[model samples]
Target: MSDVETPETAEKEELLTEAEKKALIALRRDEAAALRRWWQRLTLTPHELEKLTKQRSLPRGVRAVLRRCDSAEAAMLTQGFRELWAMLPESTKQTDYRDEQLQVWSCIALVAAELRKEESGVSLAKRLGQQKEQTGKPLMSELRFQQLLSCRTPEEFIQRLRRALALADKKGVSVVLLASVIALWWREHRGRLSAKPTQRLGFVLANDYFAATSGYSHRKD
Candidate 1:
């Protein structure tokens, strides 16, 4: 093999790179769609959903760890974590993203415990913006939303996300959308430096929130 790349070799390499990028994109799309379907199935099956959400059905120890554990590692040790992981799509079970997946699972488990029911077909951020007080203000204030976006570490993100999920549950937001967004957020946050700036989770959320709130405000006016 030559030490230096020839022009023909370089062109072939670039084409291969493009093909790999397309394959990766397709894989991600399939994974996301699979996850959404999994959530939909869980929501449709009350008995199954109850096993994860109801305190009486879910073991006390597992529930406690999920609700209060300071780290994903601690949560992963519990039976609830394993059960939750088992319920996830196979495409999401890759060991390469083990830590990130565990954190996402932890958040999903916590939110599921609080979820009264699924409000499918709505984005989480839009649901938050749609929740209004008697005085016509968004239930999730801009400051709180900023706090969520500003979290610097996994611990901080988990803590703030717990509060946000609680609010979403109370406001009747879609748990399916909520979980999916949380997973997307973790993926984006972890690979943020390598990801295009325009494709950020924060940007997606901010746009959805503001657009919904703006529409709500106009309707109220």
Candidate 2:
């Protein structure tokens, strides 16, 4: 009878352990679902969501660099790189050969990509600087002259270029344009702008708004 009682108690303990494990798994799933919903609320597109949702936590130094991103767009790019790198297997990451050093290289690549896409050559050159690193070489010719020439209007192109420059972590010729935009917004929309960094981003959005408005104009005046 004593032996039977001991076996029965052991089986009951195992059942409780299994029940606890199920509860913990349910809790983790619930937490993950809540995180996904919150991320969706941040206005990430499907592509961006896929990139960000799969990342492991960044190392402290890398996370600090990402947090220091000057623009929301740059921050998005940083997040993209982090998630992309994290998705790579440990062996793949080791083969790529830079572990933590990859963050700085990735920063340069991201800034270069943005500049090339936005046709901000003058700013790109300044950001690339006097001492050229191997990472900077990959971007030198990716930014083409023809892309800048395709602009419909000089002002439109300049504004887009300025926005890209403003996002760069380094000093560049277009820093003046960035400062001017900030000052203009501060003067014109004092009440709305305030101390909020995001409010100052109206300059970038204003370009799109103006372009849309321009498209609707008829020359009948």
Runs off by more than 4 Å, candidate 2 = 1-44, 47-67, 70-81, 89-91, 99-101, 108-221
Error (Å) of candidate 2 at residue 115 is 8.3
- lDDT tens string, model 2, 1-221? 01111113333233223322332211222222222222222233456545534423333343444435654346445653454334323443464435432433233223322321221112233332222243323121224322432334323444444444543433332222222333233233324443644333343334322333343233334
Q: What would the per-residue lDDT of candidate 1 be over residues 116-160, giving only the tens digit for each residue?
A: 455545556776776465556775899998887777766777777
Q: How do the predictions measure up, each by TM-score? A: 0.66, 0.20
Worst 10 residues of 1 by lDDT: 1-10
Model 2 Cα displacement at 148 (Å)?
15
**What is the Å distance of residue 98 in model 1 from its true position?**
2.9
CA displacement after TM-score superposition, residue 203 of candidate 1 (Å): 1.6
Which stretch of 10 consecutive residues in model 2 shows the poorest summed lDDT? 1-10
Q: Going through the candidates in order, what is the number of backbone clashes in each?
A: 0, 0
